[model samples]
Target: MQGSGGPRKTLPELLSELDTMLGLAPVKQRVRAMVAEMDIDRKRRAAGMKTAERSRHLVFTGNPGTAKTTVARLLAQIYRELGVVSSGHVVEAQRSDLVAEFLGQTAPKTRAVCESAIGGILFIDEAYTLTEGDYAAEAVAELLTQMENRRDDLVVIVAGYPKEMDEFMEANPGLRSRFANRVEFPDYSNEELAGIFRIMARGQGYELAEDLETALPQRITRIPRGRGFANGRSARQLLEATITRQSGRLATMGDIAPEALNLLVANDLPAPEDSGVQQGDGGARRSLAELMAELDGMIGLAPVKDQVRTLVAETRVDARRRSAGLKVAARSRHLVFTGNPGTAKTTVARLIAQLFRELGVLSSGHLVETSRPDLIGEYIGTTAPKTRAVIEKAIGGVLFIDEAYTLVGDSPSDYGPEAVAELLVQMENRRDDLLVIAAGYPADMDRFLDANSGLRSRFGATVTFPDYSDEELAGIFEIMARSQNYLLSHDLRQALPAAIAGIDRTVGFANGRSARQLLERTIARQAVRLAAPDVDLDALPDEELQTLHVGDLPVA
Candidate 1:
């Protein structure tokens, strides 16, 4: 955009690049049509003929990672070359970029973003989010006014899911008339994804360890495509993940030659189950073995893991006995998880839902996590309806009610009893498909369960989560650092464990959460030391980029 401070390519050269681009035939056709229409309009104006009014604003509807933003940027450059806009820059903004926290702050924020894109295109990503709240409405209104204010020099493009985009346009009359030009970006096929993967790998100077012509495409196709499926982006993620796995695989070796440095292996490719679903069926359940593996992968939950394994075994045996026409024991699928925050209770609950789905106890492995505010209502008689609505949403899945004790407070007008009554009715009615898990502090959760005899009788099992020790916390910190592409130096490593060991872990002390905060703060401290404003970032050494020394660690 704006020629990027370089010699600009001709329009024919740009068109040729589009022609050679993989997939997007429909998009190419639309671009050609727009070019022809604009060219004719120019010629007609020169001949003193009348012309119809047109809007340069557009809407792009598609799933994630289908190159919508890429195409939009190219279109901005083309528009500048064609004199449709004075500058060919693209300013990208999301809801967070426009909407401010307070009521009066949104208009100025939206206007500033719009003004920045005056001589260019303003690209609003996930534009459907503008219809979410009253504040977002203010942003949308401000955007429309700005679009009209700078109509001569600026264009706007809004991108999101097809259905959501349609609804967004219909929800506002101004949006319908202004953003009339719509282009649909189709999801990339397996062949197209493989093409993108190869281009990305080669651009980064990496070569595949396996045959790209056959094995690569097959591997990509086995990953399931759901509603929010990131088509091209998923392929890129796979390639990056494979590279990370390759690095881990090579780390144990003594040393590697220069030749083997950029080679990605077939074994590094993510397996089909790695995508978290079975291909060919959107609702296919995970296998029991796969769920077990997933549960076992968590960092430090020995007791919870053992309980889940035993439950899985018992459920499978019970199913076998039932199939053989023998008397089978019945167990309540509901549960209670008692632990401090960030102790992996919620994570385990999610895993339990997947396990139950694999065990044929539930139709879907979905988990609806909620809190007291989500269940209880504010008004005189609205609590039951609110509670019922939540239960209805969690039907055919696990309903995870976090901080259940908060529902009951020390007030006579409290609606906790009403919400609880409705929840009990739904739990009994939807017993076949719904599984409820009430999770919170150990003592508070016991009180919550004791509040209703029915809830106490139904949730037959409790899985207690133990807080992580300082040693375990250090391991977590190392994992977090590695995931974020940073390495802890020996000095830093030596300091972190001892610092974490001295942390005050009382009632309010979140185990893994505190460790994560420490890790992030350490990274921030690293940036503070190394990320100077006057430094030439491109000239930084690789070791400097990777290493975090003792100074980065906080003094506990």
Candidate 2:
């Protein structure tokens, strides 16, 4: 009756708003198409068509930071412009907001949310979490009943992990029919991730170095080659980490370069370092026998050690045959090192690079370790150059991408896919000189491989890194303490295993790296205690610094 919000200018306004946002073209197109269709249908109905349809509900299944919520907000504006609703407001809710503690309370909570979302879009994020318990199930059912009755007045969108979303739909048969249109938000490909990075960087007024631009994409391509658990979420994490590092460096430099203000330079992204662990130059030239002997002195990596030895042996045989004038085909350039943190994936990568250098497969064999942020650039066209720079740096050596699957995000339109396209080309061309290793959680890696056929073909090896057992974690803690010149008291040693076991029982805290974090925290706490004003360092015995008791460590 209000002439569809001043002649439907909001649809164009929404598109214009998103075009400037960067790395969301696919999503923009989809939204535009939906809005146009809805507008056309509305006009036909007003001109006297018997059937007039309401706004369509959508399901967005993907990880965080893939622009789901951003798109949902824009869709609200489009719906209002198409005469489907009066207000264009977009209300967001998570499981916590909808599900209450007591029985019957959840329904009212969910109803209230829906009522507020009337004449607009209701976006439920992490929607699968709500179906986990009985209270959540009741909330979901009540929400479904409301959707059926208010289909003409509101739009509802449910989003979550792909598998979890399927399960959520299965839990309620009525929901499947109610949410007829499903829009899958695939993870961003590497190119898209790079595009997102470029966008973010530009927004902050930073310029990337030319060399970094060439090398970054190759790094991005190598990200999801083997491991499964990483995806677009990982890409976003890398960006955040890079930004933190850049900000720290900027604070030290006083004023950043005007051109570089929107860019990420190579120096801004440094390879991860290990404290108090030095691998000498001679260590790089060591023979397989010598390398194994050196590795023997390192503690609590038996599984990884065994796998490395086997791989080394096979590479050695191939190298010898090639040197003797026998033509041996080059081995696959892809490797999957599957292990939780602190199992030494980075260390292993460094060792492998050195090994390849010794065998003459690569010229320098230096290792370039990067996550998604390294490849993603901050503008629409800049992603290609930024990703290319990362590949260039890794050209003569090994490129290790941690949590590689982060190259993909929740939507097909995410800029990460573009980065992947660029990466796939470089990987094919640099197969002889470059070795790419991707590591992440198993399931995510599988999904990543499923998304790209070329990635599956290139990655031939898959290595699994299992979490450390409680006993193994205890041994690791003892090793770390000894290296730091600290001795665990008898009681402390006995209590360590129980503490580690308790930590492992907690969700997301069972990794081998968890033990190392605990040990580090304990040392810091002990140092603080020793530095107290009441405890004079000059008066304290040397043994006090050397000794660590159960009280020195935090309780699990």
> For candidate 1, what's the RMSD?
18.7
Decoy 1 TM-score against native: 0.51
Compared with the true structure, the alpha-carbon lDDT of candidate 1 equals 0.79
**How much lDDT does each candidate structure score?**
0.79, 0.70
What lDDT score goes with residue 419 in model 2?
Answer: 72
Every candidate's CA RMSD: 18.7, 16.0
Question: Per-residue alpha-carbon lDDT of model 1 for 441-506, expressed as tens digits?
Answer: 999988888887788888879989988878888888888889988988888887887889867787
Give the best candidate by lDDT. Answer: 1
lDDT of 2 by residue, 1-556 (tens): 1112223455667778877764555566777677777878878888998654543888886555667887887777777877776777778888888999998799999999988888888899989898787698888888888888788778999997665776688788887877776665544555666676566666666676776665555344333212221345545445556666767777787667765455676666533221111222213355656656766666567777787777777777876775465787656758877665667677778777766655545545578888889877655755655566576567557888888888888875576766777777777765655788888878888877777778888887787766667888888888878888999999898788778877754556735578778988888888888989888888889899898888888866
The TM-score, computed over Cα atoms with residue i paired to residue i, of candidate 2 is 0.49
